[model samples]
Each structure stands twice: as structure tokens, then as C-alpha cells.
Target chain A: MTGAALRLDDVACVRGGRMLFRGVSLSLTSGGGAMLTGANGAGKSSLLRLCAGLLPAFSGSVVRSGGVALCDEKLALDNEAPLHRALSFWAAIDRADAAQVDAAMDAMALTPLAEVPVRMLSTGQRKRAMLARIIASGAAIWLLDEPGNGLDTVSLDLLGQAVGRHLSAGGIVVAASHQPLPIVAPVTIHLPDHQADAA
Target chain B: MRLLWLLIRRDLRLAWASGGMWLPVAFLLLVASLFPFAVGPDAALLARTGGGMLWIAALLASLLPVDRLVAPDVQAGVLDQLAARGIGEEWIVLARLLAHWIGFGPPLMLATVPAATLLKLDAAAMARLELGLLIGTPALAALGLLVATLTAGLRSSGALAGLLALPLAVPLLIFGAGTMSDGSGAAFKFLAAASLLLVAITPFAGGAALRAGRD
Candidate 1:
């Protein structure tokens, strides 16, 4: 995770022929965290996506100095495979060894459900599985969109601890959530109204 | 190289788990099984036209898996995750192309044995048909992938994929069917050329399509 960084320079996003946000900028280095807060449809998720380079910024630039792992609304795991095997698919793709997958599952307390199919997991369990995937990815920068949406209080604590550990290990985290999370982030970007005119 | 192999392996596993591999073969078999009944049991007529019929069946069979090729992964964020791993879109498309070919091409060729028997084809024509499929199916796989990437996000993408691919696949069909009748090796040469061109362009074209449609 050396030299890990996620930087955005005056980023703007336009989706479906409408501008969602503009003039947003943030720079995160190793051991740094940022929380994106905004009302629904205020481009919080879009900003996270921009940082991950999954969506192109309408203007400005996003640059990353390390591998990025994004955990959004989609579980993105194979539905038919067992939970451990589904996570292993991404683990293999990320070039992370099998032990990493096991460790990630352990972090999220998902070891018991290892043999369950992903589709059968409860909503909260599925969210944990998604986080496990990010952990196993071994990526330096994590982009989490609404990671707390379906999580319980205990799971929320797990998520916060995971983020804390990742930052302490020289990784960067950029998360967007409407609800308050337990993780402490030094920087917070609260997106303004979409219709507000800001050049 | 490991990345490519892993991607191919994952694609093959997913295709198998989803039952996508047998669909085209089943469709090919179904078409072949029904062909004799439609035209009546005239062996000479069956032999002469069956080769061409097999060509048509293969072409249509190729379209069966097109909807699943790029769309599911895109929806699942598989491609984006791969992209974030510094895996280029071209490499993803290339791996998918190879996996798709393996899923359909060889099995379809094998299925053609029973299919050819059902169609009343003689030995020589069966050999020509098999050879033609070997060369032409790669192009079909390429075309399906190309169209799948192009139509991934659109509504009714399955129908749109078929519409987009059928036109582009006409050349492979021509060259493939041509091999059945011509005694000379010219049709095989042309078929090989068409396959090479499609296989070569698929990675670039399909990769661009995926990138452009990422939003």
C-alpha cells in the first residue's frame, strides 16, 4: 500500500443529461479517509464512482496511485457459488492468495456462512460479504457506496473497524453514506443542491 | 498471462454454471432434428441442403449466448472490477472471446455429428461441414461478443443483440456455406480469412464498446 493516493481535481458529474454535482475536489493519501455526505440524488455515489474511475468525470480529473476496490449496491459475487467460492473468484482475479479470502471472511465474521450460496444470504450478510471482497482485493484505495445501508449495529462496528485498520495499514477509504458510520474520517464532502448554480 | 488465464477460467466456469454452454448446442440439435421433418425424408435433398442448413443453424446458435456474454458481467460490475485491477478492456474481451469460443465451437462441432446424421449427410459433406464450422464458428463467437458488448445496456438487448449480430455475421455465413459446395479450397481460404479478421478485430471493437458504455 505504499504511495497509495486518490485525488480528484475539480470533479463534476453529469448523468442522464443532467448535472449532478460540480466543482468537487478531494485528495487522499495513505492512512487517510474521506466521507461523502449528501442527500439522495445529490451525486454522492457518483463521486465515489468517479474516484474508482468506473464513471468518467464530466469535467476535471481523477488520479489514483494504487489499486482501487469499489463496493457499491451490487454484491457483484456469483449467485450460484458458495459464499467462500464466490469471494474466491474475486480473490483470484485480484491475485490475492486464498488465505487472504479466509482472513477477510474472518474479519466480517462470515466464516460460518462459508458454504451458503450467495443468493441465500440475508441482506446484512450480503453486505458483509461485499466488504469481505474488498478486503480480499488487497487494494490500497477503497470506494464504498452506501455500505451501511443494510448493515446492523454490530456489522456497522465491523465495517468501521475494517476501515480503521485499512487506513492504519496505509490504505485510503472514500465512502458515501447517508446514515452515520462509526469510522472517523478527517475530510467530509457534503454535496450541495443539484440545481444550485455553482461555477 | 495469468490474468488472461484466470479471466478465461472464470468466464468458462460462469458460463457452465449458468448453463450457457449447452444452449447453442441444444438449439443446433433441435434445428437439425426438425429439418428432416420439414422437407420430408428425401435423402439426396437432405444431403444437398443439409450442409447449408447446418450453416444457418450454427449462425443462429451463435446468437443464443450473446445476451449473457457482456451484459451480466457489466451489471454485476465484474468488468469494472477487472478494469480497476489494471486489466485492460481489450484483455477482458479477448479472454471472453476465447472462452465463448470454447464453450460453443467445439461442442457445436461435436453435436454436428449427430445433427449431420439426422440431416442425412454423407461422409464427405460431413467432413466439409465440420471443417467449415471449425473456421467459421470463431467468427461467429467474435460477432456475438461484439454485438453483446454493443447492446449490453439497451432495452430488450437480447433481441437487439440478435439484430445487430445477424447482419455482421452474413459474411461468415457466406464463406461457411460456400465451403460445402465448392470442391476447390478457395471457400476454405476465404472462410479462414473472414475468421481471422473477425477474431482480430473483436478485442479492439468490443473493448471500445465496453469502455464507451461504462457509464
Candidate 2:
């Protein structure tokens, strides 16, 4: 976790022949966090994907050191499995032990719901489950897209504490959300400022 | 290697949970049972044509589970999560191919026994049919999976998958059915070669398709 870093240099993104954003650049070392603030279709999600190496930048480059974990809108857990088991699958894939899965569930206050099927969870619980997956991943870089969408007050607090602990451990976090998040992202990139002109 | 096994186990569990593992076997049996009704109870004719009919049934049975193979995982974000974990798309597709073959191939072979009995096939013909299926079903599974990956995100992908897979499967069908009558070992070799080719290329082709489908 010590050497974690994420850097994007003057990146431009085009989708379906339309430029979404351009001239975007940001760099974060270990213990650093960046908040991407933009409206819908502004490419906040695309930018996060670009940073994760899941999407290519239309121009420029994204460079990262250390592993990455992304928590997006879609819950990747198996719907039929119990919450803990669903999370454990990913933990195993991430090569983390059962202890981390248990710890992540506890961190999100999801211990009580561990035995419940994933599909049975409400929206807020599902959101927390996604967070627990990120926590259990133990990746040095966390890319969270709208991590607070359906969370209530207590759950949101749990998210804040998780981000705090991750940053304190010298991990990098890049969260994209239109709504205000509880963590302190010292570098804020309001994407509209980088929007490309329409031809 | 452990990760590959883990993925195959997960896919098998999902296939079992969704009842997809049984669809191909059931379809095979249903087609076998229906053939006699369509052709009447002419025992000689049944024995002569049963092997070919069963081959056709197996080919169509392979298609039944194609719709459930790749699309659900892609929509559920499973592929993206695995990709983010540094697992290659080819590994994922290879694991899925193995799971798919396990889910349908052996069961379909077993189901062929009862299906053959229903079709009034003799012992010798039944042996050939089973051998043909054992060698050919992996190719069928691979074909289905490859087509599933290609058509995963398209609207009405199930119908599109059939149209895409059936034509490519012509060689397997020909060689598989050919084995039943060609007393020589030539047909068996052809069937094995075709199966090997499909099984070998499915991982790379399906992996590329999955990666390309990602946005």
C-alpha cells in the first residue's frame, strides 16, 4: 500500500463520436483522494473507468501503480448467495482471506445481514455490500462511482470511516459522485470545466 | 490454476441454480421422444435413422442454454469485476467453457441412453451414438459459448445466437452423424478434429468478444 499512485494526464474521452471531456489531468500519491464532480453524462463514470484501466482515454494517458478495486452502481455479487458468501467469492479472487471478508462486513455494519441473500437486501444495504466488497479487496487504489447513492445517515458514516481508514493506511481513493461525499478529497475535479466544445 | 477452478465452480453453481444444466438434457430427451410420433412405429426405419435424429437433437439441445451463458454475467458486472482483479478474459472464458461442457456434455450423454431406447436404436448403433456425442458435445458446448459471447449484449440475442451457432455447427453435425454409419474410423477422427478446433479457439474468440463488448 505504501507506493500506491494514480495519475491521469490531459485525458480526453469520446463516446459515440462525441467528446465528453478533455484537458483533464490529475495525480495522486499514496494517502491521496480525488473527488470527481460532474452531472450525468458528463463522463464521471467513464473517467473513473479510464483510471481503472477499464476504458481507454480518447487522448492522453492514465498511469497507476498498485492494484485497483472499483465499486460501481451494479452490484457484482451473486444475487442468490448469502451476503458474506457473495463477498467471500470476490475476496478469494482478490486473494484476501476470510478474515478480511469478515472484517469488511463488520466495518460496514453488515454483520447482521451476512446470512441474508444478496437480492433480499434493500437499496441502502446493497450499497453497503458494494462498499464491503471494495474494503475486502485490499487493493491499494479504490475507484468508487457514486458510492453514496442509496445510503442512509449511518451507512454514509460507515463509508466515511472506511475511506478515512483506507487513506490513513496510505491507499489512494478516487470517488466520482455528483452528491457531496463525506470523505475529504483534497483534489476536486469539477468535470464541466473540462468539457469539450461541441462542433 | 486455483483461480480457474474457482471460476469454473462458480459458473457450475450458477448453472445448477438457474436449472440451466438440465435444459439441454431435457431438450435432447424431448426431441428423441417426439421423433417416433412423427415417423410412426416402423422399427427398421427408427433404427436406421435414429442416430442421425439424435445428433440433430443434441445439436439443438446445445442451443437451449446458450442464452443464459454469457449475457447474465456481463449484465451482472461479473466480467468487469474479474477483469479488474487482473484475471485475463481468456482465463475467464476458458473456465466458463469447461463448466459449460461439464454442465451439459456428460448429462446429455447419459440422457442419450434413454433417448436412444425411445428411438428403438440397437446396441451397436447406441454405442456409436454415445461415442459420437462424447467426442462432439464439447464442440457443441464451445460453439454455443462462442455464439453466446458474440451475441451477449444484442437485443433478442437468443434468436440471434441460434442463427449464428447452427450454421457454424454444420461440420460437427456432419462428422458426428457420419460416425454412426461409416464403419471406417475416418468419421471419428474428423469429429475429434472439429471438436478440438472449436474447443481451442472458443477461449480466445470469446475472450476477445467479451473485451470488445465492454464500454
Candidate 3:
């Protein structure tokens, strides 16, 4: 399966007595990319989370492809779990290939750390491990929040290549970041800067 | 049907991998043994108290594993994902309760035999002990599941879980222990009646609590 198109209608989100995003609407097609850009506190992460259904939008609706893989900056790993177990915990439900796990691990430069527990890894390494895990999730739509947070020059380029490959494979990708994103053909929707109710 | 099996197996696998299955059974045994030590070795006292003691230990042991039924997996975002997979939330709750039964309920029933011995119960009492445990442990798992789902978000949930479960569990305990005592045959009938009601309504209550957690 490649990817399904995603659509949102007037997706408004409010938090902490503040309106994060209001009357936000966007549609992303297969092989399509939308860059979510905003200064801090402008709801980039919040918007991405809403798209992933990890957080509820205060108003409006979000419809996305099933099996949406969310790769967040925090790298939600259970501390007591081994890298293999934590990575494979949910994937244990899906009958996927060992080859896909290997491909994801190699793509993210996480093969060597596969034996380490999540608590043993450094922040950057944990992030990379999470990227590999979600890649193995085989999700059609990749909602990434700060995928470029702590990556060095090389990993940033690696991430750009990953996004490119994902898009070229007819997958949908939405990335929320503050810094200049490393992708091409991305429909740049500035969160606060480009708050038009239509996209 | 395949997904249903997959879910049941997945829950079974996770329960096994967590080293969670045996802990409560062991706890029940240890708690049962302590009663003999604390009260001295009067065999008649042990015989008379055995059934009630076994029921009490089963109740406590059964509750120990309730948090494992959903909270950790929920915090990990696994349960929400399962719900999103077009698996009805009710089935998820049922699957989880079944898994809890496998992990917490059956072993509890098995432990009652040893508990009967520890409390110096005779053969007739042992049979009734088995009956009480067989019916009551499921009720325990059901009510525990309900409380566990309700208290998922609280920090001091262990206390809250006991608070929520023990009151509801009282009837099961009374009927359960009654089934084993030298009390009249009528007591055993009442135990069966209570067990039937517990089995019937627990699923509905547990499902409702699980739905609340999803929202």
C-alpha cells in the first residue's frame, strides 16, 4: 500500500487558555509533502499531534490514512524495554518481515545500537532508534514533529533523503519543524505565519 | 476472527513477556502461608478459618494484577492504537479481561487447593473451596478490570483500585466463603446466584469503564 490522502476541515486547537490554531484546513495527497513551520509556541507540534490523533482538536475534524506513524522528538520509548523489544512491541502485532526491520535499522544508522536498552541510549541515538521503529511500522502517512531536532549535519541530510524516498514511493508526509526543512517539492504551510483557513 | 485470535495471542504474549503471570499466584500462596504462622498451628482454627482466608487471599491476589490489565499499555499508546484499528472498544475491554483471567484468575483458583491444605481444610471443604474459587476469581478479575480501567489516570491508583474493588467484591467474598463453610446448603445456592449475577454484569460495567477511559 502506498498512502491515502489526508484531509482536515477547519481543525482548530486550543490549549492553556490560548488558541493554538484556528480555522486551519489542509489536504495532502499521495506523494504529497506539507511542511509545518512556525516559531515556538505557534502549535507546530500540537498540529502534527492532532493530525496523528494523539491529541484531540478543539474543533473540526481530521481524516487521515490508516496506520499513520507518528515520529515525535521525544522518542516515546519505555525505559525498561530493550531496544529490540521496544521497537518490536507493537510491530509484534503486524506480520512484517525481518528484512524490513533490517532496512529501517540500516537506514537510520541504528543497527549497532539494536542491542541497547532504551534507557542506555543518548538522546540523538534514541531519536534515531525511534525513527527506525516507526519506519518499520509501515505507516502510509508519516506525521513527523521536529524530526530534525538534534541531528548533526549528516543525519539531517539522511532525514531529507528518507522523506524524499517516502514521498517518491507515493506516501504522504507532513513534517513540523522550526528550522529550515531539508526537503524539495514540499507545500510549505507556515502555521502562524500562513494561517489562512484554506490550503 | 483472525484479528481476534491475534489480539488474544498478543495479549497473552505481552502478559508472558512481562514476567507478570506467576507473581500474583506466588503472592497468594505466600499470603495464605502467613496466616498459619501468625495465628499458631491450631488445626481446628485453621480448618474453620481456611475457607474465609482463602477467599480473602484470592481477592487480594486477584487485584494485584489489575493495573497490568491496561494502564501500562494505555500509557504506552498501544491500547489507543488497537482501538483505532477498527477493533471496537468493547472487544478490547473483553480481550483484556480475558487476558487478566488467564494471568490472574486461573492461578488464583489453583492456589486455593494449597491454601485449603495450609488452613487444614478437609476433602468436602476442598471441593467447595474449588467451586468458590472457580466462580469467584472470574468475578474478581471482572471487578478488578473495572476498577483498573476507572483508576488508570490516578497516581495513587493501587489504593484507589482496592477502594473501588473491595466494596463490590464483598458480595463475592461472602458468597464464595459461604460455599465452603459448614453453613447450610442454602448458602451454596446463594453463592451460585451471586456468582451468576457477577458474571453477567461485570462485562457491562467493565466495558462502560473502558469506554470512559477511551474518551
Reference-based lDDT, each prediction: 0.91, 0.93, 0.75
Indicate the fraction of true inter-chain contacts that candidate 1 also forms: 0.73
lDDT of 1 by residue, B19-114 (tens): 889999999999999998999999989998999999999999998888889998888878878876778899999999999999989999999999
lDDT of 2 by residue, B1-215 (tens): 99999999899998999887988888988898889999999999998899999999999999998888999888988898888877899999999999999999999999999999998898999999999999999999999999999998888898889899999999998999999899998999999999999999999999999999998
Q: Which parts of model 3 are misplaced by more than 4 Å?
A: A1-3, A15-18, A39-41, A54-56, A73-82, A193-199, B4-14, B37-40, B83-87, B182-215
Ranking the candidates on lDDT from highest down gives 2, 1, 3
Is 1 or 3 the stronger prediction by DockQ?
A: 1
User: Chain A TM-scores, one per candidate?
Assistant: 0.97, 0.98, 0.90
Q: Where does candidate 2 stray beyond 4 Å?
A: none
DockQ of candidate 3, scored on C-alphas against the true complex (2 decimals): 0.23
**Under CAPRI classification, how is model 2 graded?**
high
Q: Tens digits of per-residue lDDT for model 3 on A117-177?
A: 7789887787777777668877778888888877888878878888888888888888888
What tens digits encode model 2's per-residue C-alpha lDDT throughout A90-188?
998999999999999999999999999999999999999999999999999999999999999899999999999999999999999989989989999
- Candidate 3 at A185: error in angstroms? 5.8
- After TM-score superposition, what is the CA distance of residue B125 in candidate 2 from its true location, in Å? 1.1
Give the TM-score of chain B in candidate 2: 0.99
Best by TM-score: 2
Candidate 1: regions farther than 4 A off: A193-199
Worst 10 residues of 3 chain B by lDDT: B78-87
Each candidate's DockQ: 0.74, 0.81, 0.23
What overall lDDT, based on C-alpha atoms, would model 2 receive against the true structure?
0.93
Model 3: lDDT to the true structure? 0.75
